[model samples]
Target chain A: MPDLGISVLFKGKNLPRLLGGLWAALRISLISVVISFPLGILLGALMTLKNPFVKAAMRIYLEFIRIMPQMVLLFLFYFGTTRAFGWDLTGETASVIVFVLWGTAEMSDLVRGCLISFPAHQYETSEALGLGKAQLYRYIIIPQAVRRLIPLSVNLVTRMIKTTSLILMIGVVEILKVAQQIIEANRTASPNAAFGVYLAVFFLYFIACWPISMLAQYLERKWG
Target chain B: MDHVTKRFGNHTVLDDISLTVHRGEVIVVIGPSGCGKSTLLRCINALEKIQGGEIKLGNEKIEYGSKRLPSLRQKIGMVFQNYELFPHLTVLGNIQLAPVKVQKRNLAEVQAEAIGWLDRVGLEGRENSYPRELSGGQKQRVAIVRALCMHPEILLFDEVTAALDPEMVREVLDVMLALAAQGRTMLIVTHEMRFARAAADRILFLDGGKIMEDSDPETFFTHPQTERARRFLSTFQFDNIKKL
Candidate 1:
């Protein structure tokens, strides 16, 4: 109502810095997803195994991920590891590592659910057809699981991207971090700049997330 | 199979049962729904373990705990009630998958044989269709031919026609009837009384985890030996056909 202060966002270094921040956010999301997806799939499948000890280990790992907050996990990876292991991790490295761990745990849980929900008849049919463990997964189990896994994992990726906003707290200049810098620099010159900058950041997130949710819906309709 | 017994945890699903099936004999296993009818076929193929007994299919005695079950199961074909075809694969692919993958047979040979089997089941033009695209009757026929392509010593069918629509039932039965005419040794678990009457050399009526009666079609239908068989057969709509 007072003054939107939309022009203040693009006045100088602010807009490009925000774009760079967006790139940083996407990069971390990509690296973490690419690394974590496969590991999560393996760990997830392993979690459903008949071995008691393996199940116990997976339970502990999944519980640790579930109970710990992402920011707390980031701090642990960044500062805690530096103190404990003496491995000085960069802010970006720590963010990537934290996201990878979080993504793996979430993706693994999704895959475990996908794997376990397969009808018992699926296993019976494959076994009855004389398929071995490898053939069972390669032919019967995995193909069926993937139909369900795609939509859910896409949703997870969008969530991981959104959650990457938390990475700014660990000193990575992601979108939210850049937005804070822009608002702080214009605090006196345009008191209304805070609202406009925040609005842009929110739209950026919406642009990124909407397509993913739409894809998830498309897959649900197409595959289900 | 001699003195074959099966148990789940402490509960015995199949109790002290013995069966001797001759080569080229068609045996139909019939019972109430929860009476371990399917488990017997599962046990025969070593898909299930027997608590205490031995099963000898020809010269190779089945080890209850052996890891080489796929090789054993390869020699024995089975079709399920659900028609569990790989939804991603087309009819030809489903039919040819095991022969090419498991047996390591020539792809060309398996493909031709699979096409030939599809032709036999009247699904020739539907070869490229996925399971989801086919009718229940077509899927069941494909499931049958998929097993037949393996060319096992004996084929086991577990309520294969039970899941089909009433209108679709005859098409699948016709396929089984032809298989019986060809004298393939088979163990069938089904509720199709007419099929048992028409195709079975012997009918085994099971109850409470044991064989209540094992008699030829003429004897079993006309005058069931046991009270259990009588009660089971009484539920059938074939009172008019119960004559030698």
Candidate 2:
């Protein structure tokens, strides 16, 4: 109502730049989800193995990921490796790598939870029915696990999207980074540009994540 | 199974149990709770590994935790106390899954066989019903049909009717009796004394992880040899029913 900086978004090219930045964040997360989902399922299955060594190793790896912060992981893959290993990794590539690693760990834990939720009799029944290991998983375990997994996985996508904001620290120029640039460019013309830009960014993130949350809720209601 | 000893941790669950089941004979194992009756059936099906000794199906020894266990299990179908039909699958799907997917049989042939078994169990129109949709009796019958569809050489039923409602027990027991009449080789563990007398060709009375008596159903039920068996049978109160 009174110079609340709402005029900043209507300015030339600012909205488009914010939308482009949103796309960048979405892009990194989408690629990460695409790559990590299958890998996570495989890792999840391995985590459930009865072998002490494999189980211990997977537990260590999972705990390592869970304990370490995602930002530190980004710096390790992005700056630390690029300098130490002498390999050229773009910010987007590094973001994808970090996101994939984090997503796979979280998603695998989700998958492992779903897998272990089945009663012991399910395994006994499948084995008694003569299902081979592969057939047992394919017919008995996977079908049921996938149903339990989907809603959680869709929620993982939203988390991944939101977490991509962290990539802005490594200069990825994602939505939050763009919002900062917008606020800086009009620092004097619109004295309250920061509030307006951040509000728009908030709406952008909510818009991106809201539908996915709805989808997860819908699946949980329908299948659960 | 010969000199089969199954130990859980430091405690022995089945201690030096030796037994042989002849072809087409229904051997019902009856005992008090925690007497290892169900464990005996589980060991025969190789669901639980024995600490000592071997079990032979015909001439081949059933190996524990081997790659061939699945193949070995195919010939020995075991039903549980609770009907463990996969909740995710329909009745027809549950029946046809192992035969079609594991056996690599034709789907149409397996489905037709499954439907036939379902019909034989008096579950003619419920092929598409999920396990959750069924009553305890109906689920047990479906579980029986699921086992029967595999065409196993023998069946091991571990207290198959124990979890059913009082009214539902007869229907499942009827299915088992029908299977016994058709000369199916079965190892049944149950507390249903009347059913044991009717369906068992031989009764093995177990106590404290050992077979205390092995005789025909009439002899074991009417004139149990051991004091433990006599005590076990007395707990059933079939004699007291007539007195009442």
Candidate 3:
């Protein structure tokens, strides 16, 4: 067999370091998802306001976030804002901030879609039943909306996990960054190691996101 | 109740409609589809904005311009044809929602009241069932009790039995008739002539957004005043009305 790069990966004690990087990426994604879920719900609800000024402001924010790519968002938060505002932010902290911003917008859009998809008669019924605003939301609106939200939210979590790889671009040393460094260091001696290393990275991502995908499918089947 | 007029962009839905419902009166509003019977009931609860009129519920003036409509709405309970129960909540939860959230009643008090209403409607055993799980008649009954838990001064039923199967219609109507016997003020929009004759104190026939005939149920059904009332009453062949 051609000199397998597997031995190379293990020989230099690089495996554990790669594992650590994977863990770091997972951690950042988890924190961002947790923060963004509720923030997304709040923003999504605010987007439905009847006030013209509030609606206009939320529309502008949603449109801006949708137009800008997440990479640009990361760079803006990590480098641009740090330099402009003169606030010291670690790479991990900045990655979380960027991911949350992106995730929140995405999740908010999902919530808005879910809320508006409900039959209009639901609101009329609540009004006829003498339900006040708080009662309407707590008893009627949110429960129905949440049923549709769960599957979409699981899909978002998977997206957040995969997108966490972008954090390595800003020097967070996540799994992909570690893989690159390993491949580069072994390039001259074993020129063919890049493909195998990328394959490993792909498997790692699949392992991380596969269960989330299953969860989304399960919720859709169960709730739909 | 006073003169109430409602317009939807230039289309008039209710025009110079004036009627008074005494305490414990059951007034049944019968009209063709799109004749604004539902709109008139919505106006009493201030759900629909009336362009040129006011509704006085007791001493309080309910107007389209007033912001205290929610407070007024609290005093009036409404039931829809579709039995608009909150799908997320259990029957008990539906009944207790307004009491706990809007009225700020204690949780135990709300639960007890909800249980009482459910029992009254013969839904005591199905308190935990969701709207999707209940039959249409049961859902409408729950909707009724949900409104009654708030102790509204007047109850509005907008074709409440119209959506039910023929067999299930009597169950809901029975509960409503029982409520009427308790002297609850009611304004019902219905196509059921028999229900009007059996339960209503007065019957108002609406046509083209105007009150074509308004009188006691006996006279309104037997001696319809205008040609419009006569034509409208003639369309329904009630088994009880023999050549009248």
Please, what are the lDDT tens digits per residue for candidate 1 over residues B88-169?
A: 7889888888888899899899888888988988888888988999999999999999999898889999999888899899
Worst 10 residues of 1 chain B by lDDT: B235-244
Fraction of native Cα contacts reproduced by each candidate: 0.74, 0.87, 0.51
lDDT of 2 by residue, A84-130 (tens): 99978999999998888888999989988998899999998998888
Candidate 1 TM-score on chain B: 0.94
Q: DockQ (Cα-based) per candidate?
A: 0.68, 0.67, 0.45
Per-residue lDDT over A1-224 for candidate 1, one digit per residue giving the tens place of the 0 to 100 score: 57997877879988788878888998999999999999999999898999999999988988898789999999999989998999999999998888888889999999999888888877877787778989988987777788889999999989998999998878998999999988898889988998889888888889888999999999988887
RMSD of each: 3.5, 3.2, 4.4
Ranking by TM-score: 1, 2, 3
Segments in model 3 whose C-alpha atoms lie over 4 Å from true places = A1-12, A34-39, A51-61, A67-98, A118-125, A128-131, A138-148, A167-172, A184-200, A211-224, B64-68, B109-113, B237-244
Give the worst 10-residue stretch by lDDT in candidate 3 chain A.
A2-11
Tens digits of lDDT, candidate 3, A1-224: 76556655675767787788789999999999999999999988887778889788878878888899888988888899877999778889999988888888899889988888878778876766556667677777887788889998998888888888888878899999999999989888888777777777788889889988998899788666
TM-scores for all candidates: the values are: 0.90, 0.89, 0.83
Interface CA RMSD of each prediction in angstroms: 1.1, 0.9, 1.7
